[model samples]
Target: MSPEAIRKFWSLIEETQTNILLTLDNDALVIWLSRQLRREEFLKRVDTRDLNAYISERLPLIRDLAQERLAYQSHSSG
Candidate 1:
């Protein structure tokens, strides 16, 4: 897709994520998980935590979003 379209897609997701974060009362588990993702210090805070598993669980939405964006671009480009 064109650069503008790509930017717009990112913008939409950023806006969506932002709105979701703002409107929903994120539970404690989600907050902790998000912190685990964001904080380097927290990575070591808890022993016996499987960070990879956490990463794996969180990766699909990112992959799906990218795949969906690519498919949409392909359809529009053809």
Candidate 2:
């Protein structure tokens, strides 16, 4: 992807993360942060060969979803 496309992709990810956070309470955030802390350690101790395969599969689904969303927006606007 070009730099602009990569930046846009990350912007989308950040937007989704922000929306998710808007729905979460502070207590829930603390709990989620605790889990994430554990996951950092867990990752260092585990094998991750399946991670790449899973991402390869999910990436196409994400791409198709974005395409469908764009099409819907275009159709609605027109």
Candidate 3:
């Protein structure tokens, strides 16, 4: 990916993260994030050629973080 594309991709990830945090909408968050990552990974791998491998490696941690975020949102909302 070009520098501009890289910047845009990160910007989008940041925006998506912010939206997820602000809305606490778990369903949409996961789907949207997945789609975004898939699209970017398909166009050009972010850091490696095997994007799925990268995702698989990070998935556990990502899941943990998402669960934690959901828990926090649930507790805070109530």
Best by TM-score: 3
RMSD of 3: 6.7
TM-scores of all candidate predictions against the true structure: 0.31, 0.35, 0.46
lDDT of 1 by residue, 3-78 (tens): 4433543454443433343343335334534454434443444332454344335444544664566677679999
Which whole-number lDDT from 0 to 100 does residue 37 have in model 2?
Answer: 32
Q: CA shift at 36, candidate 2, in angstroms?
A: 12
lDDT of all the models against the reference? 0.45, 0.44, 0.53
Model 3 TM-score, all chains together: 0.46
Q: Which ten residues in a row have the lowest lDDT in candidate 3?
A: 47-56
Candidate 1's C-alpha runs over 4 A off are 1-56
What clash count goes with each model?
0, 0, 0
Clashing residue pairs found in predicted model 1 = none
